[model samples]
Target: MTKKVAILGAGSWGTALAMVLEENGHDVRIWSHKAKQADEINFKHTNKFYLPAVVLADSIKATHHIEEAIKDVDVIVFVVPTKAIREVAKKVVPFLTKPMVIVHASKGLEQESHKRISEILEEEIPESKRQAVVALSGPSHAEEVALKDLTTITAASTNEDASKVVQELFMNDYFRIYTNDDIIGVELGAALKNIIAVGAGALQGLGYGDNAKAALMTRGLAEISRLGVAFGADSITFLGLSGVGDLIVTCTSTHSRNWRAGHMLGKGNSLKEVLESMGMVVEGIATTKAAYELAQEKGIEMPITAAIYEVLYNGAKVEDIIVSLMQREGKSEA
Candidate 1:
């Protein structure tokens, strides 16, 4: 059974997902902000800006016009970055019809509002127009996914039926999809782990080895779990793929944009310099601010995230931050 799926965004993740859906025999129409990108996808069968080497399926089409992308689509997958979700949602709203299931593949909270991506979607899309909202997340990276390598991810929503539908739409032999009802936990796990990945990358860039990286990943989960629990997420969610699994992969993998950006920062490049050079959303930088703000508001202790905040915003040297974290008062691990 083929379904019409509108994918909002054409970045690496979006293009990878579009490929996955197209492989699953769905009609995937991708909406790119840049007309040139849409043209490349439609005419050249490649998204040169993101997944350069991979050729997109001919079944997957691209359009710069939001109206064309969403027209008659059964499902809408929002793959834009966290900061751009609201703005893009607004632009797509006029084309939205009633009873359409919306799936957000983005991972992060709004910077100042601290709202999850689902919440942002709900706020941007009217209630009458929304049928179901789902969040897809896990340790999967776009580069690996684009190559059709084995990958697994979770699809979560308050609506079980919608999650099942999404699971069916994306699940395949090479790409596995699990359905979960804990939308908040799933979304938080997806968002918070990036912050930890940044810390891990920083450690690696500072000449640390596996032992140090392992410790950082372990303790990073603790910080992420604390914040998630404070915000009413299930503790066990952090132990799953979206949490610990994602934390490990992003921190260690060379393909992680966030980790690479942090690595450059740890090697003594300024944030502006690194971001300008990379020319893509690092995510963890904005997520650091949101996590720090959430911790302050909820009165939760997240030493690792706090330290990252200091390094990123307060001009604390990465070396000094690492030393201070190591020298902090020790406590029994629960």
Candidate 2:
């Protein structure tokens, strides 16, 4: 059955997903904060700023007004930046009059609060207004996914029926979807991998070899798994699509905003300078802070997260952080 899906962000990831839904014969409307972007998507059938090479389908419409986009929509996908999720969700609740599945492609935790995307959705939008909250995440990059590259992702929710609905909606020959009930693990793996991706970029910027990158990614997964387990996520979840799969792709890919941002930082640019150059939301910058705070509050030791946080926030040199990490007391790798 065809559904009316409202993707509440017109960024690259959002636009790419709009194409997926459009291909599936769903009525897709993308909401952009900037009216000019919406106009480009509607009239020009292109979003050059985000998906420069891909031609968006005319079946996918665009709207600047949230109410118009959400009106009678069966599914609302929040693909906005983590900072904007609350603001966007607030606007969505007022227009919501029916039971619509809430899905978000954002991969970052709210700063300081350290609340995952699903938790923020539950807090911002009352339970009565939404039918189910689903987190759609994995290793898929917007640029590649837009190119119709073979991609697989997981739709995770506490609600099995809701997750299956999303899985069925987006599945196709090139793009595949799986369902998982471990929302916490899937969300954490999605968010935390960016932090490690930044580290991977930093290593590249510092001209480190593959051995160093491999070590960083392996230990990065360990720290992520530790914190994830502390927060009630299944330890096994880290080994799945949202965890190891995501880490490998995000850490090595040039298309990753977090990796790009970190590569710049490692190449000796300030965080401010790096961010100014990217023109995109490098989620790891914010996620680093949230993960650092969460680790402290929960008494979980996340060395890599700490190193990234210090490099971004405290002006600590990556070299120094690496040396310190190397000198730390050794323990068995679990």
Candidate 3:
């Protein structure tokens, strides 16, 4: 069955997903905050800055007006940055007249509230307008998915049917979707792994090899699972696509802005310089702060996250932090 889908962002990921929906024979309209971006997408069928050298499907349309884009869409996929999730949701509220499957592909906890993306959507979008809130997340990169590479992701929601709806809407030969009910784990895993990705990239930037990367990734999952379990997430979800899978790809891939930003930082570039240079939202940088604060408040011992946080926010040297991490008291790897 065909569906009308409103994607509320025009970044690389948004454009990539639009391609998928267009290929799947759905009516896809993207809402960009910038009129220039929307105009480019409409006139040239391209989002040059975000998805460089890639032509978007001619059938996929874009508009700056939120109301216009979402007027009658069956599903609303929020792909904006974590900080902008609430703001965008508020803009969509007035335009929403019917219930829709509200899906968030943006992965990061809100820095101010330390709330997950779905929590912000649920808080901002009225229940009368949303049939269910679903989180679509995994290791899949926008670049790979745009190239029609084989990718698998998870659609998680408390409402089983809602997740299945998302699975059916997105799954294709190149892009496969699985359903999971662990929304808490799914969202948290999606959000928290970015922090570890930054750390992993830092390791690479410091000339560390696979052994170090492997160690960071392994212990990173342990701490992520610890904090996530504390937040009532299923422990096993950490082993699945949204957790370890996301952590692996984001940490190692050049396609990851978070990893690139961390690499810059590890090479001794300032955070401001790194951000300005990338000209993209590095989700891990902000996520480190949120996860650090949340962990401290909840008394979770996330040493790696704390180390990354100090390096990012406290002007701590990456090498010194690395040394400190290595010198920490030994403990069992449970």
Clashes of 2: 0
Ranking by TM-score: 3, 2, 1
RMSD of 2: 0.8
Better of 1 and 3 by TM-score: 3
**Model 3 collision count:** 0
Candidate 2 C-alpha lDDT tens digits along 104-200: 9999999868889999999989888888999999989999889999999999999999999999899999999999999999999999999999999
Every model's Cα RMSD, please? 0.9, 0.8, 0.7
Q: Residues 179-271, candidate 1: write the lDDT tens digits.
A: 888888889989988888888888888888999889988988998888888778899988888888788888899899889888888888888
Query: After superposing candidate 3, which stretches have Cα over 4 Å from the reference?
Result: none
- Give Cα distance to truth, residue 53, candidate 3, Å: 2.3
Sequence-dependent TM-score of model 1: 0.98
- Which ranges in model 1 have alpha carbons more than 4 Å from their true place? none
Q: Give the whole-model CA lDDT for all candidates, comma-separated.
A: 0.90, 0.93, 0.93
lDDT of 3 by residue, 1-334 (tens): 9999999999999999999999999999999999999999999998989878688888999999998999878999999999999999999999899888999999999987899888899999989999999999999899889999999999999999999999999999999999999999999999999999899888899999999999999999999999999999999999999999999899889999989988988888999999999988999989999999999999999999999999999999999999999999998877
- Ten-residue stretch with the least lDDT total in model 2: 91-100
